[model samples]
Structure formats: C-alpha cells, structure tokens
Target: METGTTTSARYRRFADLEARGYSPLYDDWCTGISDDTELLAMLDTLPPARRQPVLFLGAVRFVGVPLEGFATFRSFVLARWPEIRQVMRTRTTQTNEAGRCAVLLPSLAAISAAEGRPLALIEVGASAGACLYPDRYAYRYSPGPALDPAGGSSVPALDCSTAGPVPFPQRLPDVVWRAGIDLNPLDARDGDDARWLEALVWPEHTFRLERLRAALGVVRSEPPLLVRGDLTEEIVPLVDRAPRDAVVVVFHSAVLAYVDAEGRNRFRETMLRFAAARDRPVHWLSHEGHGTLAGVDGAMERAPEELDGRFVLQHNGRTVARTGPHGQSIEWLP
Candidate 1:
C-alpha cells in the first residue's frame, strides 16, 4: 500500500489533470478526497495497484453505491468498506471501449494498404475483445465522411472530432483474423461479466455506457478468440496462430500503464524478437498515455499544454497522433 501522502497526491493529479474536463463529478470527488485525511488513510489500506480512483469508484458503484455529494459518497464507502474492498481486489478497470477503434482506423488502414494484405489483429490486455472488431464498427470523424463495414451500417458508430492532418482512411481495413491476450478475458455473452463492464463506465457518461452495451451486443453475436495468460508469454503464440496470408498487427490501448517497468521492457523485447523471426510483415500499434511508450515520447516535441491528458498513438515505435483518452478527438502529429 502507498503512503497516505502519496495516495493523496494521486487523487489531486487525477482531479486536476484527467477528470477536470471530462467528468465534473469525478473532478469534485477526487479534489475533495485529496484533502480528506480520513479518506486518504482509508484508501491506503488497499493494495497499491487497486488503489486507483477509477477502480475504487467503480467498485463502490458496482456494489450499489449511489452517485451523491462528497460527504454521502464518503459515508457510503466507509460503511461498506469490506464489500468495496473485496470487489476492488477481485476486479480490474478493464475498460473495453470500442470507440478507440476510430483513432486506430487510420493506422490499421495504412498498414493494410502498405502491406497489400488483410490484417491479423492481436490486442494485448484485451478486456472483452471489443476493440478487436475495428473493421466491423462504423466511424464518423468530423471534417470527414462516414465509414462503415463493407456490408452496411453497424452498431456503436464511433464518432470522433479531428484536427491537424489526420490520415482518415478511405475504407476500413480488411481484418481476416483476430485474437486477444488478457489476464482474465471477460465473456461478452455472460450477464454478470457484461454487467461488471457496464458498471466500470463513469457515472456521468451515459453515452459511453450506451456505446459499451452496443459493442457488447456485437461482440456476443460472434465473439473473438480471447486467450487467457500473461501478455508477454501469450502474445507470440497468439500471433503465430494468425494466417500466413495476413499481416500480423499487434496493438493495445490504455493497457500498459498497469504493467511495471521491467514487465514493459520484457513485452517490448518479445515484440522485437517476434517481428524479427516472422518471415511476413508485422506492425506494432500502441495508443497509450504519454510517456507510457518509452521511445515514442522522445519523438514528441509538443509543449506540456498540448500533451495534457491525451494518449500518444504510435506505429512501429514512431509517433502518429495525440489522441483523446476515450477516442473523442485526435490531434495528428506532423
């Protein structure tokens, strides 16, 4: 467990940097919690990894806590500490957001076009494989035309605002095969698992919740192959399963921050080894928080103001764009 002072700083940073513009309720809650010594001490009892604001809040919500003012929220949490703690320990913030596909389309399409072959996607830290079906979902990027699956419109039409020279794809990439690696892959067809996913959505973001449900429906109808194991250990085997005719594309979004530094290095090395051994073309796509991808950040010369709260999109270790956390917007890099 982290010290109370360190935990308090985390809450402050989350409130000021991440929650301020996105969710006012969370911003207020976190800001208040930062100064609440009692609450800080309570939070310090949990495992360090499980003490994240998102996990904590989601656990409480999952256990029937109402969205109320700081005092009420604190009271409910304190009263139901045992229940919330159990939930937190057992669950993770597996935000299987499909909207992220919008930001990823440009890169995926570019790979397919460059290699002149269909893609075989392998997502590390894939929660429910919701993100694996980028080709199945539709996209509507502002200052751009509508993009849909070859057949017709699809559920969860991901809408994203854009800026800069965003490389809008002419069409969705043809993904012939898809698989995912997760420590614990959620079954989209399971009611309990699906409900837990819905509960993970923030309180004020009804739109995100609706989108999640739509994505869940699509995934349930034809779920992708989700292998359960450590990311570094399972990734090579999963990639080897991809058809030789397709180009292997390894990608992830908002997942690596959970991994420690040593683990991240191991994952990087594994990817490099696999890419070198493959006779066919292989592309690596990463959409994670700034500084989350080691070398990718070194190429980014943007001011702190420009990079704040935006995810860094990289392809083959090269910076591509600064994207919104939930795929709301994209600021394409020059």
Candidate 2:
C-alpha cells in the first residue's frame, strides 16, 4: 500500500530486475532494498521523468563508488541523490553508443558500392546521433581487413570481429549527407550534454566509456544535423530533403523498443510509403532486439547457439547479424 511496499510499483521494478537475472549485483541490491525506506526513497529521488535502471548505477560511478560493497554503494547513492536526480531529469538515458558501427560497416559499404556512390543516412531516435557517423570512424574487424576513413579521426577505432563468410568492408562508405531526428538532441560540443552521454555508459564497461568520448571527438568538429521531433513525423520530410544523388538509408539501433507495437508498425509503413513514392531505392537498416524490430526471418531467431544477446542487425528486413546489446561484438550470419 506504500511506495516502499514490495507490491508498490517502484519496488516491483526492483523485483522484476531480480527475477530476470539482470545482474547478481542488481539482484542483490533489489532484494536488499525491497523494504528499506531510505533506499526506496533514494530510488524515488529522481523526479517523474522516467529514469532508467542505469541512472542509479551511473550515479555511483559518476561520483566514484568510494568503496565497493552494498553499504558503500547505497551510501553514495543516497548522499548524491540530488545530483543524480538533477541529471536524470535533465538527461535521458539515450545511450547512443557507436560500437555498433563496426557491425553495420560491412553492410553499409556493400550497399554504397553497389549503388556506385555515397549513402545519406537518416537515423530515427538518433539520440546524440553518434551512431550516424559510422562511416567517418576507423574500424578493425578480426579475420578481415582493417577499414579506415580517408583522414581518420584519432577517436579510438571501432573494433568488431566477425565469424563465418562475412566480407570485410573494402573501405568506409562515402557519406554525402546525414541527419538525425530526436525528441531532444544532445550536441556533442555541449560539455554538459556530452558528460551525460558519457555518464550513461555502464560502470564496469570502461571500454564503452572510452568509446563514447572517442566518438564525441570524431563528430564534434562537424556537428550532425539532428532535428528535434518524433521519428515517424520527422523522418520522411528529412529524407525528402537529402541529396537525390545519394541513396537514402533509413536506420536505427536499439531504439525501436521505446516505440509501441503500433508506432513500430507505423514507422515501418511510413518508410515503405516514402520508398514507394520515390524513384530511387530507400534502404531501411535496423539493429535492435530480436523481436523489437519486425521482418527478421525466423531462421536467425530459430538458431540456438548463434544468438548471443538481445539485439539483431538487419538489412532491409533480412537478419544479417545477432549482436550483443551494446554491439560489444557480433556473430555474423552467413
């Protein structure tokens, strides 16, 4: 009957995470704090802005967990709850990690080569739009070629090793134009916005934190054209404005989960209609959870060992790769 009660909505979230094996660490915390008033109140620190699980953890990381143990973690969270809450209110956990570019690079390059020119990328839910500049970053794919930009950014290279007959990218595709649509876009140049982006990275995954900073360095010079609006509403018009000479590739990574079933269907229909109305081909690229994005052939999903994590990379509705949630690496489908 209270926010602190196990049956209350807030405590239920902790219970859900515990039930699902999110982490032994989280499972332990959820179990420990299920009835603790101080801890429950700490969880409620952030205003009603829909904070993600990572926000609480990141706060400890952001403040430097001082010492390990559950006691230390709880103290840090309670001590800095206000600061964490402020950030949670101001920054959405829109972790736009670019590590995925490594998995996406081969397909994009292939598509660009087949077209004999560059491709204009249109990313929906392009929070901070870091993934939009995959073409501009350098890459190292194990058991394959090393892909690099003409004048590569000093930003840490995207290292993705693939299995099977996946063809290594000959080169990064030429990106003639690019744009991203977001409800609230974060500018890489803005210190606070950029800091929040870095904060969103999971605490233990230090490499991811490094990658975010590296990515920010690469795109800061030439800021991405990120428009503020819903994906379904802003995508088509932005696509219309892109260079007719270049192919239009509509893409998203780990974003469709935010959209309801109807919204996802509407987004799919919108792209189909936009392509139908245009003479040039409009390729749609999706890298999301297995069932999060529709049109994956059941073959990939049916395979047992191949699926490592939730996310799958698809090219125009066909499954290409089953990947880790953050694209730490991937298992390419031949």
Winning candidate number (lDDT): 1
Counted clashes in each candidate structure: 0, 0
**Worst window of 10 by summed lDDT in candidate 1:** 293-302
Worst 10 residues of 2 by lDDT: 294-303
lDDT of 2 by residue, 281-308 (tens): 7888888876565442231354565444
Question: Estimated TM-score per prediction?
Answer: 0.91, 0.84
> Residue 128, candidate 1: how far off, in angstroms?
0.8
What TM-score number comes out for model 1?
Answer: 0.91
What does the lDDT come to for candidate 1? 0.86
Tell me the spans in candidate 1 whose CA falls farther than 4 Å from its real position.
273-278, 295-306
Which candidate leads the pack in TM-score?
Answer: 1
lDDT of 1 by residue, 18-95 (tens): 788878888888998999998888888887888899998788888888788888888888899899889989998998
